[model samples]
Target chain A: MMTVIYIVYSAVCFAVAAALLVVALHRACKARIAARSERLLAQRYVRMITALLISDEGAPMSRFAFCGRRGAKSVLARALASVSRSTCGDGCGVVRRIMAANGVEGWLLGRARRSRGYGRARYLSMLASLPVSVSTANFVGRYAGSRNRHIRFWAMMVRVVADPAAALYVLSTYPHRFTAYETAAITAVLRRGLLPLACYPLLTSPSHNLKALGLNIVRMFGMADAERFLMDIISDDADRDDVREAIFAVAAMHLPVTRGEIVARVRGMSLSERRSLCRRLACEGYSASVIMRLAANRDRHYMETLVASYKRSLVCCG
Target chain B: MRQVLIVGDSGVPRDMVAAAAECAGCAVVCVDDMAQAAADCKRGRFDRVVVIGSAPFFDGRMSVGQLRPCGLQRPELYVIGWHQSEHTVLGLLEFGVNQYIAFPVNLRRLCRKIGAPIFRGI
Candidate 1:
């Protein structure tokens, strides 16, 4: 019994020591790899940045060549990203030209095709940051309908880059409404001076969510003509939710629309939407006639929102 | 050496951040979820906490909310992701997150933020 116990203890000690040795070896290897990459990164990064600024495509590619094709691609990827963030206007155009000159577009397309789901998503994101090209845009569009949310999200960004109007259309009709990321991405794209006037027609879209998105786009872009679009949509029998969104947008923007036009549309809207509109109108300091009319409707929740807004306005005005 | 607590699933970005942290002469402890990160914050002393967002966090399905109560003593919170919105960025800032970095990971900015002087030129 004593001999058996001694043998078991020795085996356990050996096993633990082996595991520790493996861990130490693995960490050392990782450390070495990191040190090597950091050294390579330090040597190559500044040269690439300088070459990109000059728009001399050959210089960046040649500088990257010192790192070999694979290493060069990694370095260029970082440089491309840095340039994308730090510069804009024709400078961005220069960076894109340099990227194209480096064969990044083709390499990205190949990466997109050959990589698995996550790899493909990463490449799609990289492609989105580049200037839109026919092949990259086409490749991204094919994945816009992908069931994987990551692929769809990145594809939408690429779509927004390649064609904002078409992307807006896709968002309007997409079965799934915009996720927060999608909303932010679309907002960012539209804020990049993409015209909102073109998306006004979508206010009449059959999807209520799409209409809301249209209203948001209009609001974010501050298309003043959109007031006419909003009034027209509400004047017709439109989704109460969408009308609420427009009113919210209007109030958020502090844009003035005819209060009478809004009051006229309220009879057809839901109590909740009417309440929201009342709150907005009150907050925007619209005429008392409209506020009193909605306040008189007497749904308790609706009344509370309006009354709260009215009271807050009084506090401000008083 | 600076000690960083990285909160996120195991992935390329996480690994990159960890490697970067190490290269900066900092020690890294990685936890796969917020709960683990919270627990580590109680038990560990860290100089920075980097909440690396994966596709899920960027999708708005997940968040690293309110880091102040996590027992971290003066650790700056940095978020790294791809394509986070201004609203999200502002929200993170408001919630006491120190920085939100939208990727392809900016090594110079990242190294600088972590006090990693190894990048040299930046």
Candidate 2:
């Protein structure tokens, strides 16, 4: 019985060691295979995609064959997607041709419909990098409220880029408030002043965040074109948050387009309202005298800290 | 051939780095283990150094402090990863990195950023 017990213990030990060895060997093999595939992908598909992007060449037979292969197709898809955003002129034409040749565009659209979670996110990200179309934009717009934050953000990005006014409309009307990161991503696209004229209606949105977003975008794009609507929004007894956003817009406008109207309104404002405007002006680096005078009127202690904050901002920003 | 040093331990796929560098007409020298990257720095200079993976940017092992002691100089440094906050990207700037290409490196942006002049069909 003692011999039998010893034998059993030895067998258990041997099995455990052998299992560990097999796992280690399997991992090593996988790593080696991955490395080899990467080398092949880099040498074969990456350069071809790059060449197609840089030149006006049509999709070659090589790309068509690569799409049929297992490892090569994924490599081709990812590499093509990577360059899609920057492509323009003939660059876009060539990439589209390559995708057509490989049937990648159809595969992407098909996979986009079937996927969920990361798979869907990846497909959407790839789709965003492609040139815009009504169908693709609508497909992305469908996920604007995806339970997955990543999917939602990327979808919002696609929609916002495709049509800012509509996206912002949906964003404002929806109960969801985009996280700061999502807001920044959407804003970056609109920051360049490409907003459609339809943004005017959103300024009156019942949603505070949406109204604030519209005010900020109008301010950022210098849509002095919206000065009339802005004047109305500023004068209206709008949400305090919306009013604060208007104060920021007034500050951003600087010289007299709407500055006179803003100054006239400021004289009738409350202390808290004055404080909010002064804080925004300070942050936006409006002329120091304006903020300093307001700070002094608020309180001596507030003035001292406000002055210090301005000094720090100047030192850091400069 | 133009050479670049890529330091990371978090298993960022090797193909991504190689494709980016090669597309820009450079070759990549990947150092999988951060300690080994520090050791390798002593051997020679690289045209560019890319740091990726893990948190706090390059972590303590692959920080500039370790690389500088080994006499590496003037190689353009880049930090690439998924950044949770702008503060972390700003913190890396304090370390003298040349650029921070966040994760899902925009290939065209990366090419333009590195001054490759390959896109624009130019």
Candidate 3:
């Protein structure tokens, strides 16, 4: 009985090892094949895209039409997206034409619709880079109200790209506050073009996040025309984050904030706010006297530390 | 054939730039290492060297500042997130950059900057 048990155990162990080895070999082979195919696709895409860009005729478009074939759509989409991202002006127009010729939009929309969860979100996010079209917007708009926040976020991005003029409106109505990642993504989109003329509404929105976004847009775009709106926010009782953003925007744009205005704002602000304003003003090359005025009745040690740090930074930069 | 060298890590679309340069009738070489790029530039083989500013070169080991001294001819600084700031422009100019091309790069302009004939259909 003991001998039989030992033989059975050895047989079981050998069988398990053999199965594991087969699985490992299969996986390695699959990976190698995938890598090889990917390399070939990359080489083909380089040749095709370069020829397309160099050729004066539309012959390359028909060549790119093979993107509709099985397994090639994703690779083609990725290659074209890379090309589109690295180019602007007439080059971008050329890429757009290629995408159109290849039916990339329809493939992406179909994939996004069929996919679930993260897969769906991935496809939607990819759509953000493509040129805006009515059909794409209509499809993406259905998901703007999705329960999944990721999908909703990407859907909103597509909508924003589809109609940039209504960006503020789309963002202000979002059910949740914009996360840092979301803010950065939206900022990237806005960076591609001038901020819409209707951005003023974001400042006056009830949501603190929207107000913060507005302040950031103002700072980034150097919208000096919004100085009056920023002044009102500084003086009014607003969210601390909004106030901080407003001050930073004011300092960044170098919009003339009078000493009287600063003093008045300081009077209504908390000690921390006063400290932040002083530090920002000092960094922006404001006079020491003005910084001292802002620092009045606050911790002298903190003020000294801030001034010392600022001087150290200036020296380091120089 | 004009030669162009692109120095950037994975964050940059080096392959795309290479393809564009190739289409514009130039031989393109891409390297992720600053040392290798400096070495290539030292040979004076490349007509233009494009340094991507988006890569993480902050360790003080190698930087554009170091690469500028490699006797590079027509070094173009290509930076993403390019804001219209005079200070930033002047800073790049001080780095011995002959051109500051912001993303998304105008391929036609890039070809002209690199002394290559712009493609007819590009």
Candidate 4:
């Protein structure tokens, strides 16, 4: 009787193991099929984009049956999210950035938000994956203000390139902490376009973090075109010193300013004031234009720093 | 209106497109593959052909490579590779398709895709 009991127990164990193995195989098969579907979808996405990019003759292909694809759609959403993040930083791209910033981006981001189904998890993952900022500015700008976090992140990232003020505005109001991952998102925006940080059209931001962050961003801009915008916005108070410093910084970078104009403006200032102005420009990575003026005898204090700044500029630009 | 021959793979979004075409007053015939699609083309049953599928189907009604050489009686061909194999779909274009739509199709949008091209051809 004992042997009989032992045999029954052994039989049950074998059956349980077989059942578990079958379940495992089933899951593996489902996963593989899902993966292949994802690959196929991504291929379609690139093709469509390429076609859109190249063709003016044909109507855009718009018949996308993006419904009921719990598995495949989720995977596709994740893929799109990854592309956005790779292009921007977070999975968000232009449309989402704009939506968050401004509508087209909003709708898509909304879709990403509202998605549910077997595959919705994948969409969520992609939505969270923003691209690096430095690289993806222009791409996002094309569809700028995309509110979908992933797409908007890309667009905002691109804007950060040329105009960090806008990017910083997005970040400070970002509703979430900027993670290490988000640095790329920020850089992507900057790489696309550098907004004159000192002279953006921002109206009323509530957070000091936003203000301080905005100021820092205004300072980081390449200062190549800051001259025009700065001249326009050099008044009013928040940080007039920072703005003047920035102006001097731009001049010192040697961007293209009449020294007669700068000297004429500063003729009444003390020697220390003139030296500080030169140092500000030297530190801000201006071109040699400002240095030519400083190379004159009376303003000779910054001569050494200007030479080092010029060397550093060459190293940085090259 | 121009006619379109639609081939329905087992799992694609053919039904939606076909219904859309039919609703748009397009003379569309539904078939399963080259044999039937070709026959219909020969019989003056269709002016163009559209192939669509839903799930990943094995039945080979219209592989992109096979599209050009088949010498269908139809003047234009469109393939909707609902499953998203870009290489396969792009290959179809090389084979001389008017266009390829990704599926699960937005029927309303698809009607416009085929309709505009057909109208322009006229």
Candidate 5:
């Protein structure tokens, strides 16, 4: 019993010693972290001071950037990155400043897209911080359809950062696989301002994603011509749900001709088909009374799905 | 005398699948949607099934709502479509799908890709 107690005491002492050692090590780690952080901050402060002292040598961008200019930090950073690359410094460093002032967005974009080397990647990263201009936007466009996936993704990001209009041109031209990503970017561009009609064709493309995206653009822009095309496609297909989507598009348009056409078409359907068509027409804000009468007897194959969709629409919406 | 069933929606890729099947001199039964395709899959006396469509060739709006028919008695199935479904294909593959081909389907590449494995176990 005495021996066991002695062993237990020793084990407890060792555990306590280990705990104390861990606490000491933790304190040492914290001190190291603080010192490292202080050194990094001092280095940044020194760089800032040096940059300011050199600002008077005709360095508007680097000066403005050093002085913490708003709305152009990204641009200046881009310029600095570009001039730093491409043939070293020359002409009293004024040439270097001019290059910095000259849209780093373009330079980095150029390197990222066209150049292949370690230096180009550094330039690309520097340009990444700036708001891209038109030329930079155009440069980023080169990678929108890149065979390299990473290059394509970065190019797309640069499009959003650069001139958003140029980004639309890229999204409109990018492969079908990237449609969802393209739509999100293009929608942001549209939110900023209207996209051109040339972009309309891509919306209703055969690709499902593009078509869905097109439907959104059509909804947003209220383009009647696009709606007409939707109507034509819907009318040609015998598919009931597609036809419903078409009806919804027409109803969204709220055109007098479409309303009259819907009534006429609804009047022509057999009572069985009309049961389903009536609900769609009603959901489009026509009278639901006609649909309720026909719903007394609807097709068994469709009754569950259609009625559930119809009831859900009423439940959630109304 | 084993056969394959193909579900083709409107467009170029579908046509390409048809042409390749013809070139191989294998009989293929084609349909427009999953409902008809699934029905045919069960009834057609086939050894394999292939569905070729764009990203959502089998959207609920486009076909019967089922991913794989509960009563399917057909052969092994292969899908060459725009993509694997969000998560549905794993279950479908578990059910019986032999393969799932995601697109940007290059016909030449697909033919080359499948040239070996398709004929395996034959």
Candidate 6:
């Protein structure tokens, strides 16, 4: 009985080892095949892009025969998107023409519709990179309120690109508060001339996040015209974050903020807020006297120490 | 042909910039590391050093004083930034960068800046 049990145990162990080996081999083979295909795809992309770059405007569209290959649309889309992103002016027009000719938009829309989860989001992101078309916008709008936050974000992005004129409206109504990453992404899209010709709408929006974004835009573009609006936010907006953003924008743009306004704002702010404001103003090259003037009697000693320390740090860094 | 050195991490933008430069009749060399790029500039006579991407600049790695230590031959420095702010532009100018090119990169303008004729065609 003992001999029989030992034999069975050995047999079981052998079978398990054999299965493990088979799985390992299968994975290895699969990885090798995938790598080979990726290499081939990369080579094709290089060839296609090189040809497109060197080809003349009058070059026959038929010469890009690879566009018609099965399973090449996604690869082609990626390559074209890369080209389009790295270029502006006439180069953008050239890429758009190629995408249109190959029915890339329709193909992408179909894939987006059929996909779910991350796959759907991926397609929407790709679509966002392309020029906004009425059809693409209409399709993407359906997913704007998707249950998945990821999908909803990408859908909102597409909407922003499709009609930048309504960017403030779309952003203001965003169901969730904008994360930093989302805000940056949206700001990048807006920079692409998708809309919001003026940031006045953003400043006027009820959403604090949108208002902050508007302040950021003003600072970024050096929009002198928005100074009045920024001052309004500074004086009236109760949201600390929005107020901080407005203050930073004002400091960055070197807008005139009266000493009385500074003293009043500083009086209401906590010690940390005062410190941050002082640092920002200092960094923006505000005169020592001007920054000192911001300190209320209660915070004079603290403000003096802060200014001295900041100056020392600057010297050390330099 | 003009020799151009592109300093940036490997990305679509850097690759496209290299391709555009090559198309415009320049021999392009791309280096991912700022140190390696500085070394290459010392080793080769690059007509222009196009620094693509903002990481090196914003991360406080590449600076005007740092570039001097590399002994570069005073090649025109161009920084291609994605959505650069006024502060960033001023900083780049202070760092002795010849120009600040914003994204999406205008390939034609880039070609012109490098003193190369714009390559016509798609």
Top-DockQ structure, candidate number: 6
TM-score of chain A of 2: 0.60
Summarize candidate 6's per-residue lDDT along A27-92 as a digit string, tens digits. 999999876765566445644564465444755454345566656777777766665544555444
Q: Worst ten-residue run, lDDT, model 4 chain A?
A: A86-95
The residue-by-residue lDDT of candidate 1 on A216-303, one tens digit each, is 7776555666777777776664466666666666665566544776656666676666666776677666656546665535764565
lDDT of 1 at A125: 79
Q: Tens digits of per-residue lDDT for model 1 on B26-120?
A: 88888898767767776776678888763434333344443445443356777876544344566667655677876544444465577642221
Higher-DockQ candidate among 5 and 6? 6
Candidate 6, residue A71: how far the Cα is off, in Å? 6.4
* Poorly placed runs, candidate 3 (over 4 Å): A1-8, A32-36, A39-60, A63-71, A91-93, A163-180, A194-214, A221-229, A236-241, A253-318, B54-59, B63-65, B68-85, B116-122
TM-score of chain B of each: 0.78, 0.75, 0.69, 0.69, 0.62, 0.81
lDDT of 6 at A221: 80
- Report how far off residue B75 is in candidate 5 (Å): 67
Q: Write the per-residue lDDT of candidate 4 for residues A194-219, one digit (tens) a residue.
A: 33433343312444334333333444
What pairs collide in candidate 3?
none
Q: Candidate 4 or 5, higher DockQ?
A: 4
Error of 3 at A217 (Å): 3.5
Docking class of 1: incorrect
lDDT of 2 by residue, A227-313 (tens): 676777767744555665676676776634235556656656777777777766666555556665444354536755776787786
Q: Under the 3 Å rule for N, CA and C atoms, how many clashes does model 6 have?
A: 0
lDDT (0-100) at residue A197 of candidate 6? 46
Q: Cα RMSD to native, each candidate? A: 11.7, 8.9, 5.2, 17.8, 27.8, 5.4
Task: Give per-residue CA lDDT, model 5, range B1-122, as digits (tens).
Answer: 34556676633345445444544445656677777766675465665667774434323243322334555443556677533333445644553556777643434344433332343332
TM-score of chain B of 4: 0.69
Winner on TM-score between 1 and 2 is: 2
Q: After superposing candidate 6 on the true structure, give the runs of residues whose Cα lies further than 4 Å from its correct spot.
A: A1-72, A82-87, A90-92, A163-179, A200-210, A237-241, A254-258, A266-313, B57-74, B115-122
The lDDT per prediction is 0.63, 0.62, 0.69, 0.48, 0.50, 0.72
Q: Decide which is better by DockQ, 3 or 4.
A: 3
Query: Docking category for candidate 6?
Result: acceptable
